[model samples]
Target: MRKLGTARPISQKQSARKEGTRSLAKHHHKSFAKKSRSYSSTTAAMAQQNLNSLLQWSTENTVAPGATQPSSDPARQPAQLDPALLAQLLGGPSDADLMRQAMTAILSPEMPQDQKMIAWDNLEQLIESIDNAMNLTPLGMWAPLVQQLDAEESGSRMMAAWCISTAVQNNVKAQEAMLATGAVEKLAGLVLGDADQGVRKKACNALSSECRNFQAGMDELVKSLPEDVWKGKAVDAAEMDSVDEVIGKLREIAARQS
Candidate 1:
């Protein structure tokens, strides 16, 4: 009878211990969830605060109508916020949303040139990542970007080409998608005829990247840059040499691929 009594107490204690452990686990889970929610709220608040600060800075620095143009000197320009800080402040936006914002800012007729430059800079930074570059087509950036290649502004043309080059470098899927937008021909035209040396240079970079190692891209690019065009165009010697260099590189790639 004593033995039975002791065994029953032991069983009860074991059950009580298990109940205590379960309660402790539930308490810890609840605490963690509450902390997670708090952290999320704090991060969201901080993001909004940073955005407001940026807007305030932009507003304060904007040039008024008929005002003197800001100095081009880097020292005289508004101090650039650190990119890492900007990324943190601008966190939580999906890749598509951020990219769309950049494209809109770039394409907006009323956006000031300096702001547009900032937008383009943001876009260039974004496409440096392979994943972001791959997302360009699905995000609907290809058409407008291709169109921007022919923008009247030399800076726009230069930056657009640079963006293309950066995005397609080492990414086969991105190269194929860019080619589908007829960007290769447009870029080739810039390389052959654009009077702006910088535009031609960036276009050459983009042209080289678009077709490298991709046979369909190579064929389209070859058709776009005929032998006659190089010999007949009145481009500067330096510009012609750059295009020739690109041609040579592409030919080498073709020889290997064949």
Candidate 2:
């Protein structure tokens, strides 16, 4: 029989077993927490990686190579003129009608890019035909043509410059209108500032044509000509030749006028 007030002795093996179980539980708890932290860190890193990939994809798709950034100015927005509408407008009732229609089509924002180019080429041909006829007395056309010198499309600007150049060819009235409408300043700016060599050449030719026999045109050209023309730096070799030709013609015109 057990004596009163005396407790039974716990076996060393049982005590050690209990201690081992507690130690194992603590170790498991620590390991579980470590694993939870690791899982959380991995998930966050993976989310960050996914976010970076999405940004990269967005950037790659948003802008095309060599594409010009969009201008904020509404005036500089891309033309929206419909090609069909352009064709309809170009269906001429008269020379004045044709000129007005052509100008409208060129400036309209609805025109397709490819068709816009075709329209410009056709307009140039039309202008050339009118100039050859020597009956292009519609001085009103000069104002819109001058406005196109500031068109957002390089093609539009080039065609406008070419048309102006052709219109002034042997036409005194057209040249006077060109000067009066302040086209000389815009043409000079194109010559000095346009990125396209073709555009620069066309502007140069237009300046020369306008200034050939007109003293006022020559004076304006002299005033508007960039100093870089004399410096000869940054000008392309072929473009420089055109520039030199225009300068020589201007000099000739000045001498004759003097």
Candidate 3:
């Protein structure tokens, strides 16, 4: 028996304490569950955002199907990237863009001659590679550089011939493309008549490269060089035998191919 609410049964006191403890525990568990759900939702959203960014980056940076080098492996998993790093990767210019800018600098009449020379210098380095040399045709670079062979400034003419020589050297496909632009005639004209010695030499180099191992190019070159001018009859006294030597070497190459 209980004494008028002053003293309770030990079992009743124990039961009340147990009920309070259970309620507190249930409330704490509910709060924890809510927090856990929120955390899960946030984590999932962040992961999805990162996945989207990576997808976008991959799409934009994917190499064309016919690229000389493979850009990615299908088996490779997407890498997690930082936001700042992703931005950087997206903001950079592509190889095509750089090439277009260089072409513009080379072909634009309003561009400074010095800048044009620098552009040719840069292109010379690039075209040393077979892929880069092959790229000249599709980019329409061959035609413009060929046209530049007739530029008023001897320096410009020299660079144009030099660029052509560098691009076509040991690159038969590039040589064929240049030949299509009718560059051999202009190049021969430079070799015979250009006042600048450097221009003449570079022009001769281009002619030699174009004609070597390519029968059509060699025929075109022979056709372009007037026999009288190259045979030492019409050349200036100061022209020495250097021009004749080049012409004779080319004739020998042509004769071998025939």
Candidate 1, pairs of clashing residues: none
Model 2, range 149-169, lDDT digits (tens) per residue? Answer: 888877778778888888887
Superposed model 1: Cα runs more than 4 Å off: 1-91, 229-258
How good is model 3 by TM-score?
0.57
- Candidate 1 vs candidate 2, lDDT winner: 1
Q: How many backbone clashes does candidate 3 have?
A: 0
Per-model TM against the reference: 0.56, 0.51, 0.57
**What is each predicted model's overall lDDT from 0 to 1?**
0.68, 0.59, 0.64
Of models 2 and 3, which has the larger TM-score?
Answer: 3
lDDT agreement of model 2 with the native:
0.59
lDDT of 3 by residue, 1-258 (tens): 111113233224322222322333343456546677779798578667767878887876666788654347754434456655454345433334344555666677886665565555555655676887888877877888898898898877887888799888778898889989999999887776677777787888888777666667766776676666444233321243644465566444333321
> Residue-wise lDDT of candidate 1 within 3-86, one digit each (tens)?
111122321322322232233334345654667777979868987888888888788677788887648766557767756557
Worst 10 residues of 2 by lDDT: 1-10
Each prediction's Cα RMSD?
24.7, 34.5, 29.5
Instruction: Tell me which residue pairs clash in candidate 2.
Output: 79-109, 80-109, 80-110, 80-111, 81-109, 81-110, 81-111, 82-110
Model 3 Cα shift for residue 61 (angstroms): 18
Question: Pick by TM-score: which candidate is best?
Answer: 3
The better candidate by lDDT, 1 or 3, is 1
| Error at 140, model 2, angstroms | 3.1
Q: What TM-score does candidate 1 reach?
A: 0.56
Stronger candidate by TM-score (1 vs 2): 1
